[model samples]
Target chain A: SQTIHQWPATLVQPVGSPLSLECTVEGTSNPNLYWYRQAAGRGLQLLFYSVGIGQISSEVPQNLSASRPQDRQFILSSKKLLLSDSGFYLCATSTGTGGGQTEAFFGQGTRLTVV
Target chain B: AQSVTQLDSQVPVFEEAPVELRCNYSSSVSVYLFWYVQYPNQGLQLLLKYLSGSTLVESINGFEAEFNKSQTSFHLRKPSVHISDTAEYFCAVSDDGGFKTIFGAGTRLFVKA
Candidate 1:
């Protein structure tokens, strides 16, 4: 059972400010970590995924970037935030097994408000 | 590439009544289908999934979804609904290797008393 811990349940930042959202996983090692953004009244959008440390793949290009500093630590960063960056960001992890992914466990998410 | 479509944006159902949330997908390769539930102000939770074998899958909380390969759909259903069932349901699809998973727009299930 993997548990995802995300910090700062809610954040209010000004435009052009830097942003960093951290996510750490417990109960699993070398898991596949992902960053997803859900805009209000929209679906989950895959932002980035990392298979291992220092290995990240971006799904969509935006003002955000992701990094896997450690096996269980995933970080989403933005050099300069924009108003459109304001949304609910989620950190999720899943174990790859039998050529398929097991259930994905999600964090409580961070509601980012860029003013 | 794979994409998922949740037909309804919101579904209003009465307590103790049957409810179904429709989902359809398009993919070039074999995929793993999943249904995730998101409560208000909370993250999404995996409800159930269909990888292989039986097309139908059941969740612990009395929710079930059938994987219809022919129709390319995975619709979630429950015989009787409760207020606790109110949440946003999302349909997801991933490749066989489970690399990238895409989620649908989400269907908000509102259970009325």
Candidate 2:
């Protein structure tokens, strides 16, 4: 059974501060990782996705960036957070090629509040 | 490119009543459809998915969705929804050969007692 873990379940930061959110998956290797943000009562917006280490794809241009430093470790970072960056950030992982289904498993999510 | 549309933003239904949430998608290529449920303050959970098998896919919680290829729709239906079923439901689509998953605006289901 694979599980995804995200740190700083809830975060409060002042405007223009740096942001770093970490996600790690246990029991799986070489999994595809993704970062998504959801506004209150709104749909999820894909920020970035990584196929492998040092490979990241940006979906929408925003103040955030994502990195896959390790096979099962993904990090979402921001040099200076904006007020619009306040939302629920989710980390998801899917097995590599030859895996059964393409369904993604998500972590508990980090709720960031920028004040 | 693929895009998903969830028709309803909010659906209010009495407990134990039947409910249906509509979803439509536009993709030039064959795509995999999925329905995910998000409880309050929780991450999204996979409810069901339609890949290449039967058109109808069911979850363990009595929710079923049928994929209509011609109509480009995958509508979620539940015979009797419980109060616990109150949550936000999202419809997502991904191309068969692509890794990007496009999600809809989502529909909030409120099952009142």
Q: How close is each model in CA RMSD to the real structure?
A: 1.1, 1.5
Report, for every candidate in turn, its global Cα lDDT versus the true structure: 0.92, 0.90
Candidate 2, position A14, lDDT? 95
- Scoring each candidate complex against the real one, what DockQ results? 0.64, 0.49
Say what the RMSD of model 2 is: 1.5
As a TM-score, model 2 comes out at 0.96
- Per-model TM-score on C-alpha atoms: 0.97, 0.96
lDDT by residue for model 1 (B1-113), tens: 78899999999999999999999999878888999999988999999999889998999999999999899999999999999999999999887866778899999999999
User: For model 2, how does the per-residue alpha-carbon lDDT over B51-80 read when each residue is reduced to its tens digit?
Assistant: 888999999999999999999999999999
Candidate 2 has an interface RMSD (Å) of 2.8
Maximum-DockQ candidate:
1
What pairs collide in candidate 1? none
Stretches of candidate 2 off by over 4 Å are A96-101
